[model samples]
Target chain A: MQWEIVIGLETHVQLSTRSKIFSGASIAFGAEPNTQACEIDVALPGVLPVLNARAVEKAVRFGLAVDATVNRRSVFARKNYFYPDLPKGYQISQYEIPIVERGSLEIVLGERSKTVRLTRAHLEEDAGKSLHEDFHGMSGIDLNRAGTPLLEIVSEPDLRSAAEAVAYGKTLHALVRWLDICDGNMQEGSFRMDANVSVRPAGTTDFGTRCEIKNLNSFRFLERAIEYEARRQIDVLEEGGTIRQETRLYDPQRDETRTMRSKEDAHDYRYFPDPDLLPLEIGADSLHSIAQSMPELPGAMRNRFVATFGLTPYDASLLTTSREFAHYYESACAGLSGTTPKLVANWMTGALAARLNESGCDITQSKVAPEQLRALIGRVADGTLSGAMAREVFEALWAGEGEVDAIIERRGLRQISDSSELDRLTDQVLAQNAAQVADYRAGKAKAFNALVGQVMKVSKGKANPQQVSEILRRKLALPGYFLPGA
Target chain B: MALAIDDVRRVAQLARLRIEDAQAAPMLAELNTILHLIGEMQAVDTSGVEPMSHPRDVAQRLRADEITEPDRRAALLALAPRAEAGLYLVPKVIE
Candidate 1:
């Protein structure tokens, strides 16, 4: 029997706040082990936890962006657990009360769009890091990351395949970055995902045992880990073995997952409201104020690019994926109004993107300014330069800090659109290639291509090929040459 | 509302505790007491009430899109239990 994979993702997004979630300690990464640890972070006796107002607002912004219901009041609960990284013994997280709930994100996979609904987005303080070395035979702990605020966004098990999970991840990545809530840096562990995967028979209603894969930071790893886990689970069931529900770690080097521990139900955490802090309450006025300040998200921006600029959906999506690229493209089309949008989009997607990728720089860091890019496109539009010469001019402008007009003048890359000049070159070519010209007179239609090549060679590719061809045919029919259909 | 013995052992294993078979009975009894107390929370009837994820009503703060500093390799390695040169020291598994 065929099996279906049911996958859910719980992503921990480290809020982009400067200070710790519940304390005034610096929330900087790669700091001294115990230096950033405050009394609240270390869970010192009699120390109270104060919520960061900014962190709450960030969660609210996410709720509004996802069109989720924001809780006017929620309670903080202490999740009782004992680990070396968790100094508090009980991690202060939301249990029954969470900030945002019942939201959905639309992800485009291949040609179809899928809506991945969010279970909830809860706020919790992060634990410290545990260092285990092979030779030391001992473990060490760093408390710098302790008390760091994390917004754990949990998704429903609506994803079917690894590709769908990856598409959902990318959509979330873009949303958080666009909203400026989280930095969404996978390398920094600020944005991380824990995926729960299980397989049930294709037509069966009963769900199979699930495994949770932890600490998948990159999208490639997320896809690979899920694919590996789903297959592993299916193989286990096919072999007449019962699959165990457990938490697993993805060994990226080996490209396999191993059991870390058994999965926990909510009753296991012994969750209770923390007596140290009061329940969080927000007014409608505050939510409205934050909603007003949100910038145009990626989805709306992509729609605008297609509708306003008349660009293809693919081109618009590609350009609007990065905010900097979209801003640069818009700035390039500031002065020109008509069809400049399509022209600018082409240059950005083609030459500009190629150069940026080759040099390993972002659009903002590239030396080519929007105005200069517009100038190069203007040359192509007005026919002062052929499409071929405009590319060379773009390269010159990109490599050097020279204006488009200056590069055009210095390289003498102007197109020869003048019919008179082209005619002279064509006639000179006819005189020089006498054998080919006689062959053309003797009704060899292919001989005319050789004459056009000679004109281009003489003009050093500066002559317009179209104008040269037109002038060549006109000159060939002027006298005793038998120019058929000329 | 008390937790069953199987539930207590499951929770212990989830938390990575190596509880012996003999210790399971008493631990199960203690866990039942705690679960009974926590069960009081369910009695509050939070049917339509939203769950609180954080404390305050403020949004998340942001930083400028700029690389501020280099990775402090030496300082970070100092926290590791074992380190040699710039890399963390681990056991050699391969021959």
Candidate 2:
């Protein structure tokens, strides 16, 4: 029987707040061990945890971007657990009521778009990192990440397949980065996801028991883990075995999900409202101000790029992957005299994107400035440089060579568009290849192309291909062509 | 209301508290008395009354995002049972 895969994601977005959520300690990553942990972070006695204004504002901003309801008042609950990294016996999180609720995000897969419903986005403090290696048999606890602000975004099980799950994750990742709320750096552990996957008979409305896969940081891992988990569940059910509703960890090395320690199953979080902190209240004024502060969301900007710049939806989506990239494209397209946005986009998503991926650099770190790219594209449009020659100029520009015009002049890479020059080259090509010329006259169509190739070759790739083709067609079509070179 | 010896033992285990067999009886009796009092209070709940999260009727005050704490790795690590390389070392926890 065919089975349908169902998936839900819980993404933890590390806010870009300068300080810890509850304390004044710096939350900067890669700090020396426990230096960033302060009294409140380490759960010192008599210390009170205070909320961060910036963190709340960011959560509200996210809610607005997704058109979600921003709760006016939310409570902080204590999730009691024991771990070496958790200095506090309990984690402060929003349980019953979160700051943002009932939002939806749109994810695009190929030509189709689907909306993934978001259950809630809550405010919580991140636990410290546990370094398992080194120090003999003992584990080292680094509290530098402790108390860092996180917005745990929980989504409904609306994703049907692993591909949909990946698309949803990528869309959410782009959204967070576009809003400037989270850096969305998966390698840095700033953003991570937990996927709940299950499989049931196709066309069945009833849901299947799902096993939670914890801590999939990268998109590739998310896809692979969900696919493997879904297959595992389907196999178990087909063999008349029950799937245990337990938390499992994805072993990317083995490409499988394994059961985590049963300690996770025995977790009685004993969630209760923390008496130490009062309910978090967001006023109407603050909400309105945060809404105003939110930048144009990715979806809106993508639509604008399609309508305003006359770009394809896919091209627009690619360009708007990040706010910086969209800005770069806009800057390059501004005041463009002859080039179309489509041409600029092609170079960006095709050539420039490849270069950026090769060097592991982002658009902001590109050596070729927007103005330089615009100049290069303009040369191609104005017939000053052929498409191939323009690419060479682009490579030189990327390599920190001189300006576009200077490079073209220095390398003699300009397209020979002069009619006289192109005519002379075409005559020389026809005269040198009498056998091919006679074949063209005798009704062989391909020989005509061979003649044009010779013209381009004689011009050392500087001749305008379109002009050479036109001249060759005109001369070869006429009867009785004498061999001048002979 | 009453409590079993097993319940008391399980609670102690969950709390990570070491309770001897002799103390289990007294702890169970004391916990049963507290539960009896709580059972009496549960009978008097008004349906319209909202559940109170905190005793005080005040909203939380938010602090501005700023780094005012200095690095105190040395002082803090000195208080731990064991520390090395500016990290608190404890029994290895795999899960």
User: Which one is best on TM-score?
Assistant: 2
Residue A27 miss distance in model 1 (angstroms): 0.9
User: On residues A103-134, what C-alpha lDDT tens digit does candidate 2 reach at each position?
Assistant: 89988787778899999999999999999997
Candidate number achieving the greatest DockQ relative to the actual structure:
2
Report interface Cα RMSD per prediction: 9.2, 0.8
lDDT, candidates in the order shown: 0.82, 0.90
Model 1 residue A470 CA deviation (Å) reads 6.0
What share of the reference contacts survives in each candidate? 0.03, 0.87
RMSD of 1: 6.1
lDDT string for model 1 (A266-349, tens) is: 226778888777777787898889989988877778778878888776677777766787889889988786787799999999
Q: What is the Cα-based lDDT of residue A8 in candidate 1? A: 97
Give me the displacement of residue A3 in model 1, in angstroms: 5.8
**CA RMSD for every model?**
6.1, 2.8
